[model samples]
Target: MFQYFRDSNNSKNQVSEFILMGFPGIHSWQHWLSLPLALFYLLAISANILILIIIKQEATLHQPMYYFLGILAVVDMGLTTTIIPKILSVLWFRAKTISLPECFAQMYAIHCFLTMESGIFVCMGIDRYVAVCHPLRYSSIITESFVIKATVFMTLRNSLSTMAVPVLAAQRHYCSQNQVQHFLCSNPAVTRLSCDDRKINNIYELVLAWTITGGDLGLIILSYALILHSVLKLNSAEAASKALSTCSSHLILILFFYSVVVVLSITHSASKTIPLIPVLVNVLHSVIPPALNPIVYALKNKELRQSLYKVLKMNIKKT
Candidate 1:
């Protein structure tokens, strides 16, 4: 199956398209599974769009934190949209063939948005750290202009760094198997298909994964640690409780994001026995969070709850 070049006479022949298996173990029921997957895609896209609309319309939400949240909502939508639509096409329509250029495009988008999301989380951590640890300085520290600059910095940093991945992967010689194991154009999944020497690609991916994702995670931990320390310093139990409560939603989102990611990594490594687990997790990691993030924020945030309630009330009155 890993035959790209025909022979000495046709050595220049190379793969220009790939087939996505789209859940091999349960291939028979893949169509049935598409129902929930399609719904999840709808939910994620709608929820993120709603969040953006609410943030944009509500002047009260024009703060640094909300700005970061808006960026995160955009990232979430991008992340899921990059993978889920292609998945639905495969599962529902049996459109599994994707050209190499299109595959590389998807790969770059997935990496860019995931990294940007991680960076946005770190910004949120900083916002919370300032709000909880230094309430007085929060206003001065996290201004609208500051948030814009941070957004730009995060976008450029992730986009420029991740640009190399698709470029490098596209340059490789794909000689044999043109079928991707996962639903999406994942870095390693696509790279493993190449017949060229992939040592540099693998090493580069590892270094960036650790440096970018690991570094962002470390900063998030440190921000929360300081937040906890500050909360403990509060003399009144009620004040400490309030501070901790404010962080609960953020911590939940962070936990969910990282936990799924870690599970996906583990499943990929241990996929020798249960090969289906990694593929499923890879798809889930993209959609589940985007679908649930807005709900999480609305439930835990008083301002957001009020804004949503107001929007609903106005819509009902119009009807």
Candidate 2:
């Protein structure tokens, strides 16, 4: 069934779109299932957008670390935005189909934001490294120019990284098997239906997945290693305690964020029979972090707490 239906080749037809069987078995309480997801979606996006606004308007958040935090917040929101709305539609609206190009765009956007987020986290770690390891030179070193360069490089790198995926995917043919396992279109899902030899595409996906995603994750880990080393060398107990506290917050976030993605990847790879309540599992990776991030930052970082409270006061006044 996976053959191109050119005029010359009438016997074979390509699959132009995919059917997403998102959460099939939740027949009993679809409304109950969808309601909480909608609420979480709204809460996550709103919280992240709020943090972005406060970071932009509040001049005190202009440091290299906070600059990366603000960008990461935006990326987090974008990532959730890409995934959650589609899930909501399937759960709440009973819409489950995505056109071929829409699928590719959604996949690409999710990967882009994922790449951007990984880079930003590593960048923030570097900021901490410099701040702690080279305290005397930190001021002169982490200029706005440096931050811009890092961010721009990350953008270009991530955008360039996945350019081959859709192009390669287009070369293959599908014989109209519209059923997809999950809610949204994913790389392996789209490629699996192709008539052409997907060895190259599969290889490319591995390269991008491991090299880009895994490689970026590696850098983040290394950055933290160095930061930890530097933190440990502190002579004073109070100084070490403070450094450890800062490290703890970041470690909590990193573990949660990456753990979700890794688990999702593993589940997606393994599950031949995509269960019902599938949208809910996807929600774990998308909505939870954005919803939890502001809370983490507010509770852990003094600066964000003060800024958050001030922003609340400003909103109260405006109302």
Candidate 3:
């Protein structure tokens, strides 16, 4: 699958394909990793699909919170799908060589979906804030139209911003070093292999990361802070507890998602010494939170659980 082109000035060949090293220093045991990864991928895909179906089927779940949840389900599936299959292929079949175009596409999809997920988290936080802080105005503020607009805005914002990462990466000149030392075509992983000055790519990625993920996280934190203040002012402990419970699942999802991301970033810095850790963390980030998201929501949400039960009961009887 390797293609090459001669540079105009130099006779050196430019790389047009990349080899994905799934997990460095663990080549012998790499195939063993496939089963668990495949299971997690299946679980993530199925659970998110189930969440979408339940949300669509249950009239009671057609509210702002559930609408955001549905969007999140879609994003989670996209995020996992962007990389897991290729990772699995690398592990199971040793099909590690990826063409330039495919690598760039994967890079774009992964970052785009990641940013979209962050945006959805921000939207969910806003929904919770409105519901808790201004109960009477919740309906007016978080209507279907508001949901539609927020979804559209989130999709466009992340899509356009994340596109720049891969676009910049594609413009770089890749020489002989085409081996991406990661399962998927991560921006840094691929860009660092280019035999070109990566200062601009590095700076843009840093600014983009802080702008999208950091900015979204900041907004989510502010929304929760306001929610906490309003919940505290409630006269009854029951009201406060109820409001907190409503946010608990979201908080858990946010913690799991961002905590892995933080760890992954940290490990990347130390990856020179502990190379395997970052790759493992990257796989975990792509799989674990996504697999657990729907399960957490279903367990925490009484209405969703009941709806799921009703659906299961009907399916069982039909069988």
Candidate 4:
């Protein structure tokens, strides 16, 4: 479609930078978006950082669960940082130019952290599974060493898998139209601008999503299935209720995560009919989880709540 605008010089096929179109048909009020986006950025960053600090300062939070939570906070921060800063720049200052390498880097980081989040969710599901289904071996199964290994493996696996997305995107010959319609450098959005075919990119993305996110979803479902079985066999209604309650927060988080994802995917496909929904969903998907994760844990987990209270008290005393 962009063939006429294709780079004529064979020697310089790649564009140096791309203009990120923050939002379509709303440039007049784009500045108004800065307030909420900035607020989300602040909340996500501060909440994640606070979670990390409290986990570090309180030795009581040195368990495997907290370790995983700390890692989740780190990933959430990375995920938010990947897009929000650039988004704020676009909305606040109309500075929308992003270098090719920088765009690719953002794409890579977003996918990597997203995949890492999925991996962490799977790990958390497994942690819950062990705690409920195999109480005697919970400690042995999710030790400090195991956490380290799990973190390393998750990082490595996702890094290796997600690297291809940016690599493939960078390889594409982007011609005259260098304006990206979306806020972030998403794979499909970037690929759509290319003069060349993106069949491989599309297929690879589908396979990757199904393999990583889809597989994680499957494992989570299976884990909960076994958990339900164990809970049901408890014989006592109170015990069953308690066991189900323990999974509630994780379930809520998972539901929000996947629900947004599914809705975004659907909206993207039908975007011509409903143009603004996908953009809003895309922005929310990146921001809401990070802002909510710490709050969820703080509200739902007794240990984290007490530690947060202690941290707050200490800060209050300093004043």
lDDT of 4: 0.86
lDDT of 4 at 243: 78
> Candidate 3, which ten residues in sequence have the lowest lDDT sum?
1-10
lDDT of 4 by residue, 160-241 (tens): 9998888777767787778988888988778788998888998898899899999998999999999998998998999888
Cα RMSD for candidates in order: 3.9, 3.8, 3.0, 3.8
- For residues 160-182, could you state the per-residue lDDT of candidate 3 as single tens digits? 88877777777787877988888
Error of 3 at 295 (Å): 0.3
Using Cα atoms with residue i matched to residue i, what is each candidate's TM-score against the true structure? 0.94, 0.89, 0.94, 0.94
Clashes of 1: 4
Residue 136 error for model 4, in Å? 0.9
**Local distance difference test, per candidate?**
0.86, 0.75, 0.86, 0.86
Higher-scoring candidate on TM-score, 2 or 4: 4
Pairs with backbone N, CA or C atoms under 3 Å apart (clashes), candidate 3: none
Candidate 2 local lDDT, 90-114, one digit each (tens): 7777788876667777777877887
lDDT of 2 at 298: 71
How many Å off is the CA of 271 in candidate 2?
2.2
Compared with the true structure, model 2 gives a TM-score of 0.89
For candidate 3, the per-residue lDDT at 244 reads: 98
